[model samples]
Target: MKPNASSVSVVRSVTRSAIRDVTRHLRGVGLRAAPLALALTFAASGGLRSAHAQSAQTAPAGQPSKAARDEAATRFKKGIDLFKETDYAAALVEFRRAYELAPTWQVLYNIGQVQFQLQDYAGALPTLERYLSEGGRQVPAARRTEVEADIQTLKGRIAFLDVTVNVADADIAVDDTTVGTSPLSKPVTVNAGRRRVAVSREGYTPQSRVVEVASGDTVKASFDLVERGANAASTAGSSGDTGSGDSSVPQTGTGSTSGGSGDSGSNVPWIGWGVTGGLAAGAVVFGVLALGASSDLQDLRGTRGVAASDLQDASSKATTMSVVCDALTGAALIAGGISLYFTLRTPPSDSAASAPRTRPSQATRAPRATWSSASRPQSSGPELQIGISPRGAQVIGSF
Candidate 1:
């Protein structure tokens, strides 16, 4: 009545298949009964000639591979040893390895503690911030206090910038070296003294000013650059009025001249007046453009489900236009003020002397038109076409 070897083999195969199906079903149900099912099946099979029992005995259920477990244990041991020896730096390396193997808040806390002990307050600030930001109720109050104090101390020594440049994209130079672009909002530190500040942008005259910085105090200074036309006027006035006979003839040297006084007076009057009128026009254009950009930005903010590409394009164009208009407008105003000041102080020429000069007026008007054109809002089609390319967006002249 004993079964033959082939018959017994067939029965064992059927049992193994049934066990696999049940294991899969349990797993689908989120149950952890595969190991127990395999154990019972093997025990019923006389604890021999069963592959599942042999595998289970060799590698226990739910346990990681031997190599991984060994590596983790080694890292944990090294971390504990370093912590005992008070070698925080070495400990941090080992602890970090353990954290990578298995992430836990305890490991992060240890890292933060070591960073604090090493006086790397800047590095510790972010880690502590992350811990706080996680919103875990387990973070201790004392640890929070320590991290906060460290951050506050670092902030005191850190130099920040609250830069306000009249021109956007204008390079802000501190002590003759460029630091950042204008319209920066933070406090930046320089050697506490009368530091030379310069703001420079293409198509506009460079403006320089002196800022006296005190220790632990933020210095505020802004560049009020003169537009090209206004700058030309100021240069002409300052250089052309020298008492020397050739001064009114725009001498190449730095000497004063008085001989061409009549000619200089005649040329200066209209050029100055044209520069003033152009600048005022530019101001009006800039104001209009600013209001339009603000309205567009507000509209974009309220809109939903707009294509990402369109939103990005609108935002970038609005920002660029806003900056360019404001900068140009500011430069024009500065130039206008300087021109007005000089016009009032200088003596007027007689009508007979003024009648001959007419070319300077025409020359000054071209730059004014260029400035006004730059301040005007761009046509949508051409501007969008240009904005698609890198060079187009960087066109500072037409910005």
Candidate 2:
């Protein structure tokens, strides 16, 4: 309800008296100009809203009033004073209050500056961006350039996180702030240093990790969630731990054992290459042996004194060696090609296929069986089969 003109005058008189009291208190507090400044701020803010409205019956309500602007200015001044005193926390509160009342681009600039001083770089970045974009014409080009440069510096001290959960639609969060439900389309940019990551899905044990990242780095974390059970975990990848797995089994390769799969694992490719080299060496040895044998056979055939039966025997031995050499060479080529393929190809990720295998229940386990030496397949020690009949003893190959 609108106040009567007589009531407005009385309120104005009270406001004027209060301003005087505040001014005297400020002067006594040793800030000489504070009282006068505050009085001017209050008076310029149109004294009291109700009192002003009584005098200006035609004033519009939609537009911002002179009183609000004055109050915002007062808050801005107080924030500056607190900032000079190095009380950044108090300054931040005052700056925020000013911004709330005014919401001008200049007020946003002050808020961003205060947040930066408080070491809340993440909060400051967006605020500064808003200042540059919305207050471009109001601010000088040099000021905008400085803020953009500051933003770049801030980003340098920031990092990002990209999380992958084995279970689809699992809820995910970073630093206690919800990014969204997985799988996230992009990584979340955050301040540098240690950060907490969490993922949750109904019917499955939740997974979390604390990751430390340097400035400008992007870290990817995957969660191979386990179902809820007595053996299931309540947490994973805890501080100083390398992974988020329930099993304590030692990691055998560089590839992840969680929600993602690796290409043949880190060791497999190297092992394959080693095998390839070994096979190639074997092939070379065999080829050299075959060539030596062929030369010997040629020499034997060229000799005029050699017996025909002797020559035939040497020729047969040379032919067998040559065939073996060819086989070994072919084997080397095949193995090397496979190794090369593995080294070059990017392995497709298979979250399920890479999961740990559970042991069979005692009741469902296969029964143990034993076989006699003569009946069992020849796959034991030495990889060679040897037997002696009544006729004689002879050496034999495993094949």
Candidate 3:
């Protein structure tokens, strides 16, 4: 259904009243230009388009249902009443709702005026710009000229803040008022003045900085928030130490004795055993080569076409390889015996010996403790091994 002529007249009258209100407000604020002339021209040319007319022109048929137009008209009327009453904050909300319902450019003008009344220069600038953009040729030349002048004026009172926060999703605020959340896609607009910018996130210490900016100036702010309790241990460690590098500190615990001694002595057994295993592998390899050479030499002695020099060479190769194999086997045995001895013996008591004599200062004590509990392998008393012998390709150990 279409709105009747009387209803359209009412919408236009209400729009004219809003324009008059904005003109008076601008004059009261001492704006250089008298907006009254533009306001009159705006009404004479054409005031607000009725919601039905706007929806029909902007969208295809049947869009912006009757219910939506009715709602928008109702909100528009309420916003006008609120604006007259000087309840600008509420009026701004109502006008914005009407805009969402219908998106008529007339509503943007009212929204911009209300934002100006609220001292939100940053908000008003963009709202007026959008009004001009959406209205385009529909906005009278006089109205366009006046709005452009206001835009220039607004730019003088607005400043830009480029905020960079290290943490994502952190809340950003200007002068205790929330602006946006990180990471902001663009620089935030703020009123020109001394402003406090803050960035905060959960589990991190909030950071804030004060900056002064003049009209039309852009400023940069950065925040690198530290996680809570990150430096607590380090702080304690630094404060605990006096200027002196060495200080007598008391040590009490079973940890000191076992920790230092076990760490220093534990690697010896593993090293010896690793060497023994490698040497045994070499012995096996050489033993196999020696057997092959000896077999070749024996076969050559019986072969009819074999030369005497070939026999001598094969024999010499077999003898040399056998000697090397025996040497490696003997080294393996010696290494194995040493590994067993080190594994079975108790760790040296160097840390234990030093621990009892006036405790090492807090600075020095951590290394020994860390070495004992964390660095060394865990075990009970070492197990003793009696013998290790190679039979064929395998070496057997008796415990």
Candidate 4:
């Protein structure tokens, strides 16, 4: 049924107003449920959209959606619950996940708190310190103070002891408890103050020294343990030899003895050869001179019959040759004596000081006396006039 123009227009206007009112009501409802609804929508979109939204929320303040913020808060609360239960191992995983999701100051604080509970002070220290450095303004004042105090306490408790031992690989004990073998590569920690340290090694004397360690301070103590038998022997050996006045000088090896007289009856063959060589050279020279003199005397005897002048001259020349020959023969005998003396001498078995008779002065006296006689010979004399002088013995003769 076709309506009139006014009625149709009024009806159309009512319908449009009603539609506008309905649309406004739906907008209100969407605003009220936006975060949860968007989260549900994100979940329906294969979880990638939700991750992107969450990442965006973890960005600086202007970037995050309400839904992403709520999700981060939920994860952070879950980590807190785990931490409260003292499940630090599991709590660390949860806190790390939340930190990745949001990167908020509170999440980082939770991570440090869990690490501290787990006795991971080294890890916790850096994390808390970083949070204070980067996101300090976001952390509550009370919590910041607490974390700072915790850091100080941990620092105090972390002590170091620089232990040095004189001997390597010796067993070390601290406060009567065996710690390790030296030399230690790094310092170890114990409750600060006086500690009893003992070092020991096989075949070495055990040594101990007391060391005092201060809180947060590294103390070094070095120990020198003496060898077991060394001290006693050193003390006893050094007592007699004090490096004082008039100590006898020490000598070394086989030739250190001193003696004047040596044994002289052995190795006759070599001595005889030396003597024979000297005597033979002397005999040859003297024989040559005697032959020349005999020839001259014979010529004179042949030419003139035994004049006193010629006879006297011939005798004098013969005597001089004879004396020279005798001197050579004596020298041969003395050399033989010296060679024999050294050969027959028995080497002293004891040290020179202990063998009083085996001294140098006694060894050389006989050889020197024998050599003096070989160097000089007496001339024949008949006048019987002799002069004894301080310089030497002399004889004057008229033949």
- Which prediction has the highest TM-score against the true structure? 3
Residue-level lDDT of model 3, residues 73-119, one tens digit each, is 67876775676567879988987887787666766777886788788
Query: What are the per-residue Cα lDDT tens digits for candidate 1 across 1-399?
Result: 344587568757755764565456546544333322432243224322332234334545654444444454467556545654557689678756755654444455555555665555444556556655663666567656655675566545333235676668888887677777877756565544566777888878887777765545676676676679878888888776654445355423222323455456556647766876787687677778777877787788789977778778778877876777766666565555444443443232354234443454552342221224554333332221111233222111211
Number of clashing pairs per prediction, in order: 16, 1, 1, 12
TM-scores of all models? 0.26, 0.39, 0.49, 0.26
In model 4, the number of clashes is 12
lDDT, candidate 2, equals: 0.66
Q: List, residue by residue over 1-399, the lDDT tens digit for candidate 4.
A: 234567546545644553354345436533222212222222223133334445433545654454655566555545545544546598588667755655555456556755666766545777778877876576558667877887787676545667788888899888788878899987766556677888899878898888887768888878787887897888866875654321454333223223322223334547676776878698779967977776777777777567889877987787788777766766565555444444443343455436433344554544321224453224332222334455443434344
Candidate that beats the other on TM-score, 1 or 3, i.e. the better one? 3
Top-scoring candidate (lDDT): 3
TM-score of 3: 0.49
Kindly list the per-residue Cα lDDT of model 2 for residues 1-399, writing each as its tens digit. 466678667756755665565456445544333323333334334444443564454335664455565577678667756755667799789878866765566667667766776777877888889988887686677777778888998887778888889879999988888878988898877788999999998888888889998878899988998888633333342532644353455443323432333433455679888887888888888888888988999999888999999899888888888888777766666566555544544333454335444452532342222336674544342222333456533433332
Error of 1 at 79 (Å): 20
The reply for model 2, stretches above 4 Å from the true place, is 1-78, 97-101, 166-172, 177-185, 200-205, 224-399
Instruction: Give residue 262's error in model 2 in angstroms.
Output: 46
